[model samples]
Structures are given as structure tokens and as C-alpha cells.
Target: MSSRLALPPWLRVAAAMFAVGWGANQFAAMLLVYRDEDGFSSEAVTGLFGAYALGLIPALLVFGPISDRVGRRRVMRPVLVLSIAATVVLVVGGHSLAVLLVGRLMAGVASGAAFAPGSAWIKELSADRPGGTGARRAALALSAGFGSGPLVAGAVAQWLPAPTLLPYVPHLVLMALVVPIAWHAPEPAAPAADTSRHGHEVWRVLRGRPFVLGILLTAPWVFGAASTSFATIPTFVDVDVAPVAVTGALCGLTLWTGAFVQPFGKRLGDARLIIAAGLLAATCGLLLGVVVARTDLAWLLPLVAVLLGTAYGLVLVGGLTAIELMAHRDDLATLNAVFYSLTYIGFAAPLLSTLALRAVSPTALMAIGAAVALLTIPAALASRVSPRR
Candidate 1:
């Protein structure tokens, strides 16, 4: 909101750090495949995989506001270093699923710490721009980083020697690069006006009406959209809907559409409108997926993938932007953490859908997911599109 918050070179460096940590997104996707390859039980894999969200949610809640007191760089630097540490652990301990889980938990903590404040910082730094360029750039960096993780990891897994080892190896290299940059990154001075607030205030903030509505309208989109690409697309390939390469392509499309297309979504001037449009698009995609899957129309899968992918990108960007606009500037990190918590709730959809697929047709599973998306549309539209207070 202040001119002092204008973008600077150091902000870009911080954004890079934020983006690089998203390699875990790619790792999350590949982990399921890896579990099957390594002969881990589905239950065991699910437990191990869910650790990221478990660690992330609490860290996000605890650390989000801490940055306001201690300073953004203070929180981010250590988290980035920890992320580097987790990458090392990932490579050194790949053979042990237990160690892998710990590394993921560590990575989750680092990401949760960095993501909240980092997003807030981005918006703050970009506050001087005419349009909400800072918000848009922050959204792109976050989405791109998450999106690119799969492409980079998937490519390495597909082509390089030592499929397991190669994917993480690149992350280690990126972490090395992120350290020096994070060290020198500039931050807005911590709120000079410090009021020593006690416990439960954070929870009170989370429980506010708009924030609660934000969670309800946003969660299903997060779960449904992420699962469409990560959970269901691969299954579609297995059922002969399309080739495996298409999965990667669709994943890329989903993320890229979210990252690049979001600038336009911002122009719509209402987060609720953008989210509603995205939900409707995603619903169509999911329903079409059901149709194609049930009818055995393999070629239709890619088209459906495109629809879901684009819709996901739009919803992700709009949802986050809405969160940013909805909260106080100083509260950005906490709000972001809360927003990500909802997203990770959706992130869990894949696991639930995995269990559901055992009992229902994959088509039915996707159709149900589509129905969930449809349900969100009306709620998003009905929600007031007020800018962040």
C-alpha cells in the first residue's frame, strides 16, 4: 500500500527461493508412483505422504504471524536453509521411506514458513504498481514453482540414469543456488509498531466470517483441481485414456495456465467472479472426463485434461489473490498460511480419491469430483467480491 513497497531486485531473489521450494510439489506426485515401485503398502505410503500437510499446517499457523514480529528475512532465511537441508536428506536417504518422510516434513515446514511471509512480502514489495502487479507476480512465481517441479522431476525420472536419484539431485543443486540469494534479499522493516498480543488472536483471525467463507468456497476447488491432474490423469492413462506423456503435458498445462492466465483473471476485478468462472470451467472438464472415461474415448482425455488444467490454474490464482485482498496488509502471511491450509486440504483429495477408486469406477470418481466443483460455483458467485480491507 506504500510506495516504499515497490519492487526491487532483492524481492526477485526471495521469490526465487519461494519458487524453488516447490520442487516438493513434483516430489509429491512422483512419491505415489515411487511407493508402488518400491512395494510400500498404500496405507504406509498415504501416511508418509500426508506428513507434509501435517507439518505444513501447524508451521503455517504458528509461523505466519511470527514473521510480522521477527521480520520476513529472519523467518525466510532459516527456512530456506532448512529446505536445502531437506534436499540433502532426500538424496542421502532415498532408500528409507521413513527418512524420506522426515525430509518431506522438514521441507514442508520450510515451505510453510517461507510461503506465507514470502507471499505477503511479494504483495508488499509490489504495492507501488498501478495494477496489482505485485500480487500477479507473486501468484505467478508461486504457481510456476509448483508447476515446474513436476516437469523437471518427471523429465529427469523419465530420461536420466537412476530414476529415483536423479530427480532430487537437481533440487539439491537449486537449493545451493538459492542460499546466497536469500542471504542478501531485502525485506520491509518489521512492523515498527509492535503490540505484544497474546495467544488465540491468530485463531480468532482465522475464525472471522469472510475468512471462514473463503475456506469453504475455496477448499473444494483446491482439492478437485489438484487431484484432476495429480490423482486422476495418471489413472486415466492406466485405463488407456491417453499416453503417459500426456499426463506430463496436462500437468504442465494445468500449472502454466494458472501462472500465465492469472494476470487476465485479475483484470476481472472480482476474485469471486474469477473463481466462479474457474469452477464452472473445471466442472465441465471433469464431467467431460467422466464421459470420455465411461465411453472409452481415449482421445477425449487430453482435451478434458486441458479443460481441467486451465480451470485449476485460474482458480488457484484467483483464490490466492482473493485471500491477499481479503486480509489486512500486515496479516498477509497468516492469511496466506490459512489459504494454503485449505489448499492442502484439497491436496489430500488425491489420497481420498485413491481409496474411493477401489470401490467406484474412475469415471464415477471424476464425475463426483466434477459435482463437487459444480457445487462451489454458486457459493463463489454468492460471496461478496469485496477487496481486501
Candidate 2:
């Protein structure tokens, strides 16, 4: 039966990435459920969302190196269980912000462990394929999980008993199916970095102009643009009818749009160009967000979502593709880790913007985000990214 259950190597690793991705977002739309029940402020709810980053960043910093040393399967198999446990924590969190915060933190840890290593694992497993296939597969799987998680969670939370608890059940069941297959997935060789040849390679790459200007400059907007599209933009509109489900749909719209855009981005051929185009799109989208926020327009939310989602999808794959060109085999996971950590910085955008609402208008804040995105374009273009073949 175990033999019968084994999935194709790359597919299984992709599945693990997907499952963790699903776990990472299952609670996103549930913010509405909590806020509605407890009368929590938007600030409090977004803070709960940001708590995931506190755990994720440290785990991301640690796990990539750990996986490079230990082999992908060793790290990934266990973390899937960790993800399940995190979901269990959320399942019973009910109305307690403290309990929900802990659950989110745990989910972040589980996600940070999987993301870089899983990206590297799937890339390694797809060595025989075209260069962009690995990155596209990774992006597609993660985005699919990201989009669907909220959609399902939102739907169940909107209509079901125990909204928070039941919303998490799908991910738990998903992991039970995924973990075994991932456990049996073939292991890639442990990527051992010899210090003599590549002394402190991650730092060395970090210092390179391309890495700094190309990736770091461009990465933050990846999620900055994304989080604002679904989380912040929707807050500007009042959805009295099935608001939670509507929030879920916004997440799905944003992420699924991004997932579908990867292939077109890949075809654009030059990773740097894609990154630049992405930043430009984000800038435009942010500017549009300013309009949406001021006009109190609900119909335009989908437009902003589509535009920002395009930015997220493009930069994400472009960054990964750029890393593929930049990093050595041994440092792939480490660089991936760095890239992901930077991307999560943007995840804080909604929270920051929510807090900023105290000092400035939402229109002004979104315009500021647009300005930042516009400034990033030159940095991305000036980046000495080796053109993807």
C-alpha cells in the first residue's frame, strides 16, 4: 500500500509545498469571522495576520541551511506534520486572539520551513526539464493553495458551524493525504557547500550588485502589492452580504490571477524584464488602489486585485528565475530562503497601512506604496541579471 501510494518525485514535493501553502492561508479570511465575533479592530486583526511573519522569518533563516545540510525529504516530511499541528491550534482557537496568534505563528514556522527547501527540492527534481519549469511549478502550486485555501475557508466559515474550527479541517485532511506521499518522495542529494570554494556564499551573493538591486529591491513589492489587493483594498469597501466569503473571493481572485500569469511571465524570457514589468504593474495597481479607496468603489476591487496579483505572480517567478541564474547549486536553498524572507516583509503592508490610517488617509497611504513600487523599477532594470537562456 505504501508502495502504491508513492507519487512522482517532483509532484509529491510540489504537493507538500501546496499543503503548507494551504495551511499558511486558511486563516486569512477568517479574520472577518474573528473581527465580527469579538468586535476586534482592523488593526488587531491585521496584527494577528502579521504574527505569522514573526515565526516565518526565523524559520526561513534557519531551515534553508538545515535542508541544504540534511536533504530535502528529511526537513519537509516532518514539517508537514508541524503544519497540521498548527492547523489544529487554529481549529480550536475560537474567539481567543491569544490562541489564534499562537496558531498563526506556528503556521508561519511550518511554512518558512517548506517554502525555500520545497522550491529547491522541486527544482532539483526537475533538473532535466526547462529552466523555468521548476519555478513555474513552484509558483503555481503555492498560488493554487494560497488562492483555494481562503476560498474554501471563507465559504465554510460563512455558512458552517464553528467557522474557525471547520475552516481548518480541509487543510488537516489535505495534509493527511499529502504527508505520506511527500514522505515517500525521492530525496535529492544533500547540497553540501564547502567553505573553501564558496566561503560564506549567501553573504557573498548578497553583496553582489545583482542580488541587491535585482532581488531585494524587487522582492518586497511582491507581497506588498498582493496583501494590499485582497486585505487592504477590501477594507475600503463595505460588503454587508457574506463579507467573509467576499474576502475569501478577493484572496482567491488575487492569488489565482497570479498563478495563471506565471506562464506568460516565463515566456517573457528575460527574468529582469519580468521583474521590472512587475514593479511597474504594482505601481500602477497601487495608484489604482488610491482611487478605489477614495471613491468607495466596490466594483473596482477586482481590477486592483487583478493588477496587483499580476505583479505578485510576475515578481515571484522572476525572482526565483533570477536566483536560479545567480546561485550555485549548494546555495540555491539559502538564496531561496533569503528571497522568501524579504518577500514576507511585504506581507506586513496591510497591517502597516491599517495603522497608518491613524495619521493619513487610505488614499495617501496606497499612493505611497505606489511611489515605492515605481522607484523599484529602475533598480530592477539596472540589476545585472544574466538573461535567462
- C-alpha displacement of 117 in model 2, angstroms? 0.6
Candidate 2, residues 1-389: lDDT per residue as tens digits? Answer: 55525556888889989889999987788888888888888888999988898999899989997887778888887799899999988877777889989999999999999999999999999888988788889888888888889989999999998876788889988988887778778875644567565446667788888999999888988888888888888888777888999899889888889899989997788888999888888988889888888889888988998999999999999999888888777777888999999999988988998888899988888888888888888888898866322
Whole-model alpha-carbon lDDT for candidate 1 = 0.67
Per-residue lDDT over 49-142 for candidate 1, one digit per residue giving the tens place of the 0 to 100 score: 5667777788888888787667777887788777777777777766788887888888788778877777777777766674456656766777
What's the alpha carbon RMSD for model 2? 1.8
Determine the backbone clash count of candidate 2.
Answer: 0
Q: Best lDDT goes to which candidate?
A: 2
lDDT against true structure, model 2: 0.86
Candidate 2 segments whose C-alpha is farther than 4 A from its true place: 1-6, 190-192, 387-389
Error of 2 at 277 (Å): 1.5
Model 2 per-residue lDDT at 4 = 29
Ten-residue region with minimum lDDT total, candidate 2: 190-199
Off by over 4 Å in 1: 1-7, 10-14, 41-48, 194-209, 239-249, 296-298
The backbone clash count of each candidate, in order, is 3, 0
Can you give the lDDT of residue 139 in candidate 1?
65
